[model samples]
Target: MATLLYGPQHDPIHIEDRALAHLKIVIATKLRRNETFTLSWKHPEAEPGGRSTIWIHPSIPLRFVFDEPEAPQINVRWVEELMHTANSSGGIMLVDEVLDIGEIERQH
Candidate 1:
């Protein structure tokens, strides 16, 4: 598990570590470009039965904490999918990663 600590209030939004890793890349890229967007995700089974969305801005304080000692291998295709939605008016929607078999083959 990983926690996304957003803003000064430090409201903790829990997410799976793998998802968080991909999100971190997309979020950082947008913020670096001075772009703002919203991130939406459904609540995990452990949390209440609802979805949550947050406005991500360049100036806001954001942090990603992972329980794993090392970062997981990133999925470029997943990041591209996220970047596509991040640019949309509806903003980024958190979705499960679609394994890229081609990418894995290229890596090996």
Candidate 2:
């Protein structure tokens, strides 16, 4: 399954091999321009809080291995689902769902 890190803004960021690479470039560009972004991920089955969110600056190094498992697919339907959940939170809530990264790339 592909691992995806969502933002507090409810924006779904799909990351894969080349997509991850492209994202790194985009992140670098944004950081170079002094932009900041918030990112979140699940804590895995062993964790207590269930999930965690962090504000990622431009300095974080991102690396993806081709041999790693592919991420799950993320589609409009998934976005709708997330929106539904986010809206119900009363306040803005961020979530990270595993997505098939290839799906996003294929659609493009």
Candidate 3:
């Protein structure tokens, strides 16, 4: 699992390493352009049965930590999907990756 330490409180949001890798790209792109958005996700099974949303801003401190020593192969399609939603008024909604076999094969 990977962890996203966001904002000054540094609340830890656990995500799969591959998913976090993709989210990092989308989040960085938006922040770079000085765009602010919300990230919503369902609480993990270990947590209470509910969902959470956070307002992401450029000024806020954010960090991505991966348990793995190396970063996983990023799925470009997944990033694009995330970027698309990040632009929406509803903001970015965390969803499972729709793996592109062709993309994975190309990466190998």
Candidate 4:
């Protein structure tokens, strides 16, 4: 299965097809602007409020995998929707959930 890696909030934020597209855009824009930030969210696969982070770099690949056929066709429209929801709900997007901890710190 594809790894999503997103959380620590009321709702779960799995890296589904559309979510990944929005993340690609956000990260691309941030990298284009030479800006870095952190975001977090909860994943349904984990307990409620379980959190994690990822470090986003411009050099990171944004290409979708072969199994993700629908991802190739999705557009920024979904990203826009996701942004609106996240912004209004105070939720984190895909890359937003990525953080650099400097070390493999354990979670409680």
Question: Which predicted model would earn the best lDDT?
Answer: 1
Candidates' C-alpha lDDT = 0.93, 0.45, 0.89, 0.48
Reference-based lDDT, residue 46, model 4:
46
Give the higher-lDDT candidate: 2 or 3.
3
Candidate 4 residue-wise lDDT at 90: 40
User: Where in model 4 is the C-alpha error above 4 Å?
Assistant: 1-14, 46-49, 59-66, 72-108
Off by more than 4 A, model 1: 101-108
Worst 10 residues of 3 by lDDT: 98-107
Across 1-108, the per-residue lDDT of candidate 3 in tens digits comes to 889999888879998888888999999999989999999988888888999999999888999999998888777788888889899998998888967878669769
Sorted on TM-score, best first, the list reads: 1, 3, 4, 2
Per-residue lDDT of 71 in model 1 = 95
Better of 1 and 2 by lDDT: 1
10 residues in a row with least lDDT, candidate 2: 89-98
lDDT of 1 at 13: 95
Q: Model 2: residues >4 Å from true position, as ranges?
A: 1-34, 65-108
lDDT of 4 by residue, 1-108 (tens): 234432332232355564565566655556687655544545656446666555444454434323365655444555565445444434444433332354226431
Between candidates 1 and 2, the one scoring higher on TM-score is 1
